[model samples]
Target: MGTTQLETVPEPKYWHLRTVLSNALDSEFEVGEILPNERELAARFGVARATLRQALEQLELEGRLQRRRGVGTTVAPPRVGVEVNPTRHSWPGAPGDAWQTEGCAEDVPPAVVGRALGRGDEKVYTVHRVRTVHGQPVATELLYVPPASVPGLSGIAGLETDAGVARGRAVLRELQRLELGGQERTVELGSARAEDAKRLDRLPGAPVLVLTTRYLAAGGTAAVAVSTYRADTCRLTFGESAGTGLLAAG
Candidate 1:
């Protein structure tokens, strides 16, 4: 009788498939390229349809793929970045600003925003925008301000969209009058939440740069702005080489 031996076969892993596909995309695919339809790709890889989809979803979350409801998934374009610090070299909202205006939204912000407003949550103005650089969407900005802090807001016409650098200046021009106080800013490691991830076109857990700034004016806090920037694509710059630097660290 011939000796019989049983050989155990390892189960296939879908994550391995995703890695293979991701590498292929980075090495060979062009931005906006439509990937092979799921059915075709799954058959080619000898993987189940569900397994193939799992891989695709991860790619889409990483902003590597753009999936449409009906148009199919395409390769994602690059992301944009906007500098959030007030450096001597670059003001907050200056002409030739790296970020282009996306739009503004007025809403009651989160509880933290309410605390920043000091009204316990009554006053709020949220300016929503997508900051881009070199034609990529790298960050999303939500600027919140209490109405009392922005006393002359109505007079500061059109700053939200077409105001340009001068608009930021005009909005902040009053700072010089209200005792021109100091400010506190914090930078921290963070991940993009679902909403921010959607706007920034990255995964929910993607690394991000979170800059929280509290502006002080007229013996009180004027505004608090939280800017979420993509870590993979941006390097936040602060201070200038030549000018007199006037930033207070807190």
Candidate 2:
């Protein structure tokens, strides 16, 4: 007869610490209230600084806390409810739109975008935009407008060299001249890429809601939009809503 040893799996200590800290946040902390220093919190929780930091990082990703480089950590307010669905279709820079144009460039889009637009290796107008709510940057968008959609773009003076708010406006005006029939949209979860992370002011690989939209004109793909929203700080609503509550459980 032989004795066999049982295999024991250990749960990650940081995961357990995250739960404890989350409870404290709900019951004991107020929004915008700063917490104790990391060293003090680590001591209070009887965990190593690294473990404490792991938990804190999770909290920040969940939008439960805001960590500033020089300001330390504080409780975060409720996430913003962004209306995504409307009764009608409109251009990106339409009046009262949430996004502000950052710059415009004529470059080749990502492979996925190229496939969507049915253009291979062809350069298009890439309009960079930043969407904000309460003055906080929440999303970044890269809009790829094919040459066929804006035939007059080349005729427009200073379009290639212009890289400002006005540049985006000009492009939008040219796009608006076309008859926009409708658009198709798809949403999925994705990790923030390097460029989007810098614009969103979050660490690379943070969770985000990626939205891909295709604008159709005269039965052809006119433009494509790829928007990455901060998953923790935004609650995407499909239509009109009542109160400001998280649309889904985190």
Candidate 3:
């Protein structure tokens, strides 16, 4: 590849470099290919290391690159397509569901979740789950089910023990008994919280897509789930055939 010095343009230097790098990624690099070191990249572009760093950071945020600890920087795989259409509704943990239950605990949820449940300050069963694609953790969820929703769940046991997994499974099983009237969902961009960041292997305050779902049954909200997905690895889709060719544009 030939070197191209950056021209003096009104746009920010880093922004211009980002475009140039993006084009090169399209024409030259394959997915998961390791990038040249910062010094080499800077010299090749005839820009300072600071400018090159800024450009690289921008690309990572846009999902064009990944900066893995100890592995160096490489082109990122295409974002996974996650279906978010409200019309396609099913209770979590259904046979075809992709999430794996991690644990369950009874706790007073955040104010936003409490409001969604319409049970202010009341304790609910919070089921923790992780969603992975190709063995890579991409999302984590906090599913809040009111005690009233899962009346059959018994045996108040330790939540951190092996029993916790059983408890989470029981809650999900009980939920399937109810008649699912419908569900409402909302998607928004948010910063990763400390807990969610750790699970997704991202730094706290990294960009994430927050998907909040309210499962309605018996004329009330049966459960509320707040799922945080790594924005760099996911693309929210709203169709029956979601996630197909999500990265085709790249």
RMSD values, in order shown: 9.2, 7.7, 3.2
**Least lDDT summed over 10 consecutive residues: which range in candidate 3?**
154-163
Evaluated at residue 160, the lDDT of candidate 2 is 71
Task: Write candidate 3's Cα lDDT for 88-109 as tens digits.
Answer: 6789998778899998888999
lDDT string for model 2 (54-155, tens) is 989988878888886677898876676654664568877777566888888889999989999999889988899998754568789999998789888779
List ranges where model 1 is wrong by over 4 Å: 1-12, 79-91, 96-109, 119-124, 132-139, 147-211, 216-220, 227-250
Q: Report lDDT per candidate.
A: 0.63, 0.80, 0.85
Query: Candidate order by TM-score, highest to lowest?
Result: 3, 2, 1
- Model 2 earns a TM-score of 0.75
Off by over 4 Å in 2: 1-55, 82-85, 242-250
Better of 1 and 3 by TM-score: 3
Q: What is the lDDT of candidate 2?
A: 0.80
Best first by lDDT, ranked: 3, 2, 1
Residue-level lDDT tens digits of model 1 in 1-250:
1111112324445566767787788778877678888888877777689988988877665656776556788776653323344553322354454444454545677888778768685746565556764345667777676667667766665665543445444544443345436667778879999999988767798889898877777787777768888766555445552132211111
Candidate 3 residue-wise lDDT at 62: 85
